[model samples]
Target: MISKAEAKHIWVLAEQKKGKVANVALEAIGLARKLASASSQEVWAVLLGQDVGGLAEGLIQSGADVVLVVEHPKLDTFRDDPYVDVLAHLAENHKPAVFLIGANSAGRSLAPRLATKLRAGLAADCVELSWDAGNLVAVRPMYGGNVLATVTCPEARPQMATLRPKASPRPVLDASRKGRVEKVDLGGLQIRDRVKLLESVETGGGEVKLEEADIIVSGGRGMGGPERFAVVKALADAFKGAMGASRAAVDAGWVPYAHQVGQTGKTVSPKVYIACGISGAIQHLAGMRSSEIIVAINKNPDAPIFKVATFGIAGDLFEVVPLLTEAVKKEMS
Candidate 1:
């Protein structure tokens, strides 16, 4: 256990893949900047990957005071052991006061491992974060989106938490910012090569990554069938947004599983989420209730989705979607 006096800088695990930095890192950095300011501390980013040095500039501009680079050819593709080994070593030495991670697939796996190794308290999938009484408070949905729970790691020296992607506003880019980038050597580190990644196929084809989209047009069981998703696609295309589907839609084979958004699928915090013909089940709201704006279009006026929506259109989506799509295109023209 580390003492409060011994704990220093706020460290954000700058998760990246194949050299491109994950967008969530920027949001985490933005939050770290706020948390660090309260304590008059520094925000340090720990980037782990091969050939990731080029990304240091972007991280620095995004609000990190220092970027710690861990480069290794073995890290080109994410391997559990090597990554855990390197980060565990850093935490052992630096003892950061707060550690933030993106709550993505890789981060979900890494945070728990590091938290266990460091014996730190961890709050996962936090939608909000702030300092209260000198403790970092993490707020996340609980009871299947029925309520929010605020968690705190008061006794832990290095408080650990994972922020859902886009939980915080994106940090403004300041190219004028200057920061230090230090390359750390991972020598004498014994890594257990138990898992091997033989083949990695990219999903989404040419479609936009659902989680990264600023706007999403999604459909549900009310959309009728797979062929009817064309209207949903048109609305999505009209907005230059991504296409999404509720679990019922995916389970019904109306769309691929990749487009699913719900408790069992991807969590999206887009600028705008248009729910077309979705009944707004609690499971689905848990994934996207954090969106900046929600427009619910459902035939049922009492659909639960309208509860969290910024705008509600209680009308037949069959008639609404095409007219809405035409209006958007006409305005753009």
Candidate 2:
């Protein structure tokens, strides 16, 4: 068993697919950089995939001091069992002081299992992380994001946490930042495939993914019906942004569940979030309250959404959205 005293490096799991690294992975690396600096340790990024060594340079530019690349044919796709098997093996052998994972769909599934394997503690969906003395302190939202809980694992050799995407500023890529690349050999390790990935299908909705979007325009119950959602789309198109919908609009069948943004749906932290006709339910705010800029348009001046909005319009969205779209178009033109 690896002891706490032997742990030296702070590790971040740098997730990638088909040579394209996930934004959240870079964000985790950015967070890990800060913690590593505070604790006077090296920030090591562990990347797993087939033929992904070329992607290591990008992680280096994103603030990783070392990129540990583990390549295998079984890792070509993201299957829970194989991924967990490989990651757990690495954790056991290398013995990092801290392990940070992105709190996306894949990380959420992988973290708990990896923690169980290492017999360590895990903080899920953490929004903030810091080094408190020698222990890693993670802050996560609880009870529909109304409460922020602070967690720490003082005794665990490798403290682990799944950090939310867009919670931290993305590190600026610097080619001048020098880092080392190391290849991990997976010899004699029997990677188990308990679950077979039958097929992976893409669910297409819009050009920009909500999670990665810089700007988002969402509509809600005040849209009145499904056909009226065109107004919301027009505004999103004008801003070259992604389209989002409140649970009320989705439940009302105005849009697909994929576009729903709330505690029950996809969490988004866009640079600009424009809410039209959405009365800010705590569940809804829990998802997008972290957005840098929020614009709310509701006829009701007393709407809860206005409380969190950076800019609010108390008027009819049907009239207001089109005008805003035209104004944006004119500005862009």
Candidate 3:
């Protein structure tokens, strides 16, 4: 229970990829809104990139009360040094009550550094965040999903937590909400790391990132062989969704690491997730159990995937997938 006098504005470190707002940024803003409401404070978004102000309106629509835009030519590409300097500067100047960041590659890389710079306790990969009586509580899984730990940052002035991208609900657009924009000047930050983005290879036309896809078709060991992944891809294509794979399949070289979903991979909360031949280990379930609707197809009726599945089909995936794909294609046509 944060007192009215003590609580300051909530801040979200918004990330931009290829000149577009990352989905995780919106997710963080959504969670920020809930925290801000509880504390009676404004929700501020810190966006860093070249021409980032163009994205401020979208952030406002997604529930940000105010967006602090830090636009610099050196910040155009995501390099570690410049981003860390800017975020550290913001943390020192604005003095937010709580700072939320997405637990993605960039956030994971920067949050710990920023926390160290501020001398604050940092919680990473937190699945849930809330204010308890006045203290910020960050909850995360521990002991390989065996236990959950809730941490309270009491002494830290600005508590920091990074949330998994798909762990929260999407924010509803609020056109009436308004706030001011503060342009921060990155005074003397030099780009020390010379990682240049020469080219980007967009897989599968880059239609939808698996984390943000409304529908996902995932394969597992029962997918048989790497050659058979086309069947899963066909189904994903039929639904206009992205293709994902379980850790087992990915380790077996059946799919790329980018498409793997599990404890060691991406966490996703799609509207619909279809698991084909997946055994659904606890580690795998931790990644996508938050999906709105889970459809599991496995030859073994007792597969653990069926435990949390909204719908389960016990059958050979080789026999069921093609027929299901055809049915979906027919419906779409």
Candidate 4:
């Protein structure tokens, strides 16, 4: 077991895709900056990919005091075992005080594995974090998001946690902020790649990411049918935004699960979230309550969605949506 004195830095997983850094990784760095400042520890980002050493300087600027790059041909895609093994080796060698992984596709699968390998305490999907006399404390949603639980790892040397994307504030790009670029080696450890990604297919008509969208227009059961969802699509198109759906809309076969947003689905914190005909169930609100601005359009004046919405439109979506879409198009044009 490593002592607190042996653990010296805060490590942030720099998850990347298609040779570019994912937004969640930058968000992790932003969070690590704050946590490192509180604990008087240096912030380091673990960058692992082929030809990703070019991203180290950018990570340093993003908030990392040092960027640890593990470049190899076998580490191109999001293969689970190689990634976990490499990180485990790193943790065992250079013990960190805090280890943070973004709660995204790659991270969700990787966090627990790494934690178990290192025998470290892990907090999953934490939305908020604070320091209690230099110890890290994590706060996350509980009981279908009806409650928030604050957790601390008192027995672990290197505390581990996975943070949902957009749970922390994005840091401003500062080119002047620079640090060290470190290339880490595997020490002759043979990495056996079992999973081979043969091909990849892209779905969704509009090429927009729901999680990173600045504007999102979502439809619920009020859309009636997939055909009626055209108005919602039109609105999203007019704004050049992404399309989202409540669980009801997705379960009804109106849209795919990729568009679903809720407690059971994806948690999104877009800049502007427009809910069309959504009843605003507790589960749904739990996913998007963090949006910068929320607009609710529902026929029922007493709909719960209106309570959390920044703007309320008490009208039938069939009549209101088309007109609204046209107005948005006109305003933008």
On a 0 to 100 scale, what is the lDDT of residue 174 in model 3?
82
Off by over 4 Å in 2: none
Clashes found in each candidate (C-alpha, N, C closer than 3 A): 0, 0, 3, 0
Per-residue lDDT for 213-241 in model 4, tens only?
Answer: 88899999888998888889999999989
Question: Could you estimate the TM-score for every candidate?
Answer: 0.94, 0.96, 0.89, 0.94
lDDT of model number 4: 0.88
Candidate 1 clashing pairs, residues 3+ apart or interchain: none
Candidate 4 positional error at 225, Å: 0.9
Candidate 2 TM-score to native:
0.96
lDDT for model 2: 0.92
Q: List residue ranges in candidate 1 displaced over 4 A.
A: none
Task: Report how far off residue 179 is in candidate 1 (Å).
Answer: 1.2
Model 2: weakest 10-residue lDDT segment is 200-209
RMSD per candidate (Å) reads 1.7, 1.4, 3.0, 1.8
lDDT, candidate 2, 1-333, per-residue tens = 458889888999999966888899999998889888888999999999999999999999999999999999999877789999999999898899899999888899999999998888899999899888899999998887889999999888789999998889889999999999999999999999877778877786437888888999999999999999999999998998999999999999889999999999988889999999999999999889989999999999999999999999999999999999999999988
Residue 118 of model 4, lDDT score: 85
Give lDDT tens digits, candidate 3, residues 216-326: 999999999999999999999999999999999999998989999889988787889999989999989978887899999999999999999999999999999999999
